[model samples]
Target: MEHRYLGNSGLKISEITYGNWLTHGSQVENDTASKCVHAALDAGISTFDTADVYANTVAEQVLGDALKGQRRESLEIFTKVYFPTGPKGHNDTGLSRKHMMESIDGSLRRLGTDYVDLYQAHRYDYETPLEETMQAFADIVRAGKALYIGVSEWNADQLRAAHHLAKDLGIQLVSNQPQYNMLWRVIEERVVPTSKELGISQIVWSPIAQGALTGKYKPGQPVPAGSRATDEDGGGAESIRSRYLHDDKLTAVANLEPIAAELGITMAQLAIAWVLANDNVATALVGASRPEQIASNAEAAGVTLDTGVLSRIDDVLGDLPETDPNKTQSPATRLT
Candidate 1:
């Protein structure tokens, strides 16, 4: 896999990263998770992104278990804070110093790592003061528990503010994990521009829109058996089989069949290549339940999309959706 510098931070990351959101504990079995991890590593994917909230922390444990015997120093491991891992108690979540301190310890324990390459805040916590959050992150970096700090799902303004706060305090805010894909163009406006200006790289999650772009589900047909769409509450919060995920404007799976055949690439490869077209994106984190999924995704890092193909894709994505389906927060109202 191709590698890129994660913002101005000295860390280099694989262009295609593996994520353990719906894959490790929620969907895939232990052996399957091992295959997925092996596929990623064999494909030169060194970055593995997980979070404390994913599968209630089972994701991290599974990932750690998968990476156990291999060389640890070569991989870039990332995990996030925020999101309640415990009950509804205030200490269970948010970016406060106490919560962050406790949370990182728990994360380290679960991931079987003493320190993380990058530690991110899962979301902007209005409940915590900015100082408290930034200082907590800074302290982690100072203590060598975290090499770089990042924010996930935070808007452009919040990201820039965090970057400035880190700069002022001598902490390096390296990357911002956002949901960016062909179907989710929300970051094309504010967040991308702001992150580019501040030299913060965008590590996009759900580059394939939770496998929707993979041509797995046929519209007007029964949901693919055992697919994420089968989840009662939706496999993921944003993946509730919406109109955007349908086979409507984006020319569905059938539309891309010819293109995939021509390029000898899958529809998922096209979607991932499109997301990585932006230089600001340090990595596109894709989830995988099966080893083939990881192998297929990692191949996308090498696929090239010419102007004609990109325009055809643009036409397919015409006008674009104002609302980002993958994101919990709307970019327009996120800062407001």
Candidate 2:
């Protein structure tokens, strides 16, 4: 797998990071999850991303158990804080000093590591003071709990404030994780340029638009039996249905099949390579429910799409992508 530096920091993560967002503890059995993790390692992916909110902290334990024997220094494990975990108590959410301070320790213990490579704020906490949040992150870094700091789904202004605060506190605010794919370009307008100015790179998730870009969901056909569109229990069925499941978008996405065929790669690989073409994108996070899925997705790591193929992709999906910069936002209030 190819590796790229996260933001301006010295930390280099696999260009295709294996993430267990919905699959590890919620959507798949533990044994299957471990097999997928092993497949990622075998495919040369060293970075893993998870969140405490995923399956209420069960995902971290599953990932930890899967990666039990690897040399610690060879991995870059990332986890996030924000949203409720553990009984959904009032104090169980947000980025307050109490929550962040306690969350890091819990995360480390669950991941079976003394320190994480990157600790991220899963969302901007509208309820907590930014200073308090950054201070808590600074304390986590100084206490040797996490080496660097990051945030997910934060907007440009939010990133600038936290970046300045992190600088003042002598900590590196390195990356902002966002949903970026051929169909979801919300971060491109303001977030990307602002992050570039602040020296923060993007660790993008959902590069395939929840498998819509994989060309598996046909335009007028019934929903695939085992695809995410049919997984309403613990998967992303709702979002996939509401966003990209319509016939028009599916037809547009289908137009790219010939492009993928010409390149001798799957549509998923084409989707992933599209995101990596951006210089500001440090990594594209991919997840899988099966071991072979992980191995197949890893092949997108080094694939490159030139300007013509990129233009063809845009022409195929023109005006279907979400580009509203205001769409990138956290909850107006805490979910608890």
Q: Give the best candidate by TM-score.
A: 2
Global lDDT of each candidate: 0.82, 0.95
Q: Sum up the clashes in candidate 2.
A: 0
The TM-score values for the models, in the order shown, are 0.93, 0.99
lDDT tens readout by residue for model 2, 97-153:
999998999999999999999999999999899999999999999999999999999
Candidate 1 residue spans exceeding 4 A from truth: 250-253, 323-336
Pairs of residues clashing in candidate 1: none
Task: Give the TM-score comparing model 2 with the true structure, all chains together.
Answer: 0.99
TM-score of model 1 vs. true structure: 0.93
